[model samples]
Target: MSADKTILIAGTYDTKDDELSYLADCIRGQGGGVLTMDVSVLGDPKAPTDVSKHDVAQVGGSSIEAAIDSGDENVAMQIMAKGAAAMAAQLHSEGKIDGAIVLGGTMGTDLALDLCSALPLGVPKFVVSTVSFSAMLPPERLAADIQMILWAGGLYGLNSVCKSSLSQAAGAVLGAARAVEPPKRDRPLIGMTSFGKTILHYMVKLKPALEQRGYEVAVFHATGMGGRAFESLAEQGAFACVMDFATQEVGNHMMGSGISAGADRMTNAGLKGIPQMVAPACYDLVDLIGWQPLPDRLQGREAHAHNRLLTSVLLSTEERREVARLMADKLSTATGPTTFLLPNQGGNEWDRPGAPLHDAEGLAAFCSEMRAACPANVTLEDLDCHINDDAFSEQVLAIFDQWVAEGIVPEGVS
Candidate 1:
């Protein structure tokens, strides 16, 4: 590990020269190197940068000439954003920079998002923005696994309030780059989805069983953003295989809930043909708007408040079948090997003969629809045990083991 780190300071130097310069000095005081990349769209930067706006805008596949001549701030920013991302990526590839930190209001954050995304995962990326925690921006727009800091009073210039936030961000990025080890993945990475342990506890046992067989298990929550990130990384071939057990987001989206990973959630892993095992875990619970009264359509449905922000509504027999159909249509197009598993007794922990969520009719509905829509390349498996049962995990592992032996599963670095 190197004692010193190189930090990329990416921001609009035309208007934020003082704040950016202060941040660079703070990083240097802590024994780190700085490479400032200017992303200004309107005027030339007040100070010199290692990489100018012209250098970055050209990289974005658009010319700064078009931006200045058009007199459209949007057009210029778009071009500069691309250029900044291109320049930063090139520097990182050449070992000129290790991590990045950016300070911006809104447009700055927008450009910063692309720059951070261009740098691969495991590199510490941080952004200081006024809207760091705003809910108006969908989590899907948060393109990278980038950390965000609330930029208090960092609007136009450097002040006491602004300096305090900028200084901390500078120190934080430097310390992280020096101390944080790259996220290591030496085993076959498995991407699994889950909700709560109570709803899907098989993961607790299944994780170790897979690790024991020399594979890494990476679990993604079934929340909207979690599903999106999983699919994005899947498209990038990040996982050797995936255990898509929790299908709650699928049900949530079909019902037009805000908790959707878009209509294209499960398509990536299928399109990429990564070996996958699919299950209807938590499919009985549809995410509904929370922190307020339920909609009129859900007037008589059984609902459970997952938290202050989100609630879960029990689906009817027909709705369960609809979800199954949606999933089948999506999974049927998979170019890679796939196994769709069904638990005849229950799909989740509390869904059984006498439990609160048990519905034999609902389970049957899904099974029937999936069977009818399953493609020739996909296999459907039915187990007599509950989803959380030891037998269920054993069956899933047995299939995975067979896939590995047959070279259906690959070893991946991500």
Candidate 2:
């Protein structure tokens, strides 16, 4: 009745020895194997660990003496974090561990992030942190599938309340490890980006078409976190081709909005030499957190309160031009084949003729800038229709088909 999977338990053993041990015991009780990693800098644990602090320091390319002599807590912990991350990643790669669970407060959570991120996207990584889901954790630092549980009342000493959280976290990681089905690569994978149907409907038609053509399609939402995941996969060279149409996260990052994928968004696919079909879908908007005060530069713009949590601001004509230039600049650096798809009338549903966010003049400005700023290496196709129209999808299919015929894109699964 026991699970055969092994879970790596990581924490500062000198400080949280009892708590970390409890997590290990819970996993073992469920028939799961345990491997413990101690990332402490100053003190020794009551019991020796599977991976000791000195071992972590050495893996991080420094010695325990060097870390202690740094005379700074942050510096010492960073050394430990680097070592712990590498060790965990190495263990998983060698098939010695199936999943990992890390326990900590702020300092422990910081180290936990690096350790979890070191593992690829789908090897279960869980964190028990005092600052779970807090603003202190930036969106860019999060791994796409990382899980977190709040350490609640058990910060100092383990109690019944804290035990509830720990016991659940232990069981959850073990369960996830046993249940996860790694992605199958039976067909060539195509990565596409877009909003939901209300804003962008191309994916509704595109996904099935791609699948019918013997390819696998993944549609990523163009919100902050979603874009981050898309970019991370692109960097890994995981896609056969990328249909990157929903690109608002680029402008969001350029405008210093909190809802940003990252500064490196849009450039990864190109850097990896992955073929990309780029478009400026939703390029006329900047997303901001509704709960926070609006930035001064965006205070007076046309705004749509999507929900209590999010607000979308319509960019000025001049702002739209700036974003177009930024897109062009990013495409200019592509070492791979790149194509720019320009829909002359509008980019999204809200920017159609009579919609609240529509502005013909703004759309025209964006189009002109895109035409003028597009790089010489990129093939630009100007479509005389809105992005949401049937004609737009047809044009996309035409380009995709041509690429497949020319051997630029991979052949569909036979």
- Pick the lDDT winner: 2
Estimate every model's Cα lDDT from 0 to 1. 0.83, 0.91
Alpha-carbon deviation at 397 in model 1, angstroms: 1.0
TM value for model 2: 0.95
Instruction: Please write out the lDDT profile of model 1 over residues 365-400, one tens digit for every residue.
Output: 877887887777889998888888999899998999
Backbone clashes counted, model 2 = 0
Query: TM-score, each model?
Result: 0.91, 0.95
What's the lDDT for candidate 1? Answer: 0.83
**Model 2: residues with Cα > 4 Å off, grouped in runs:** 1-3
Q: Kindly report which residue stretches of model 1 are placed more than 4 angstroms away from their true locations once superposed.
A: 1-3, 288-292, 411-414
Model 1 residue 179 lDDT score: 81
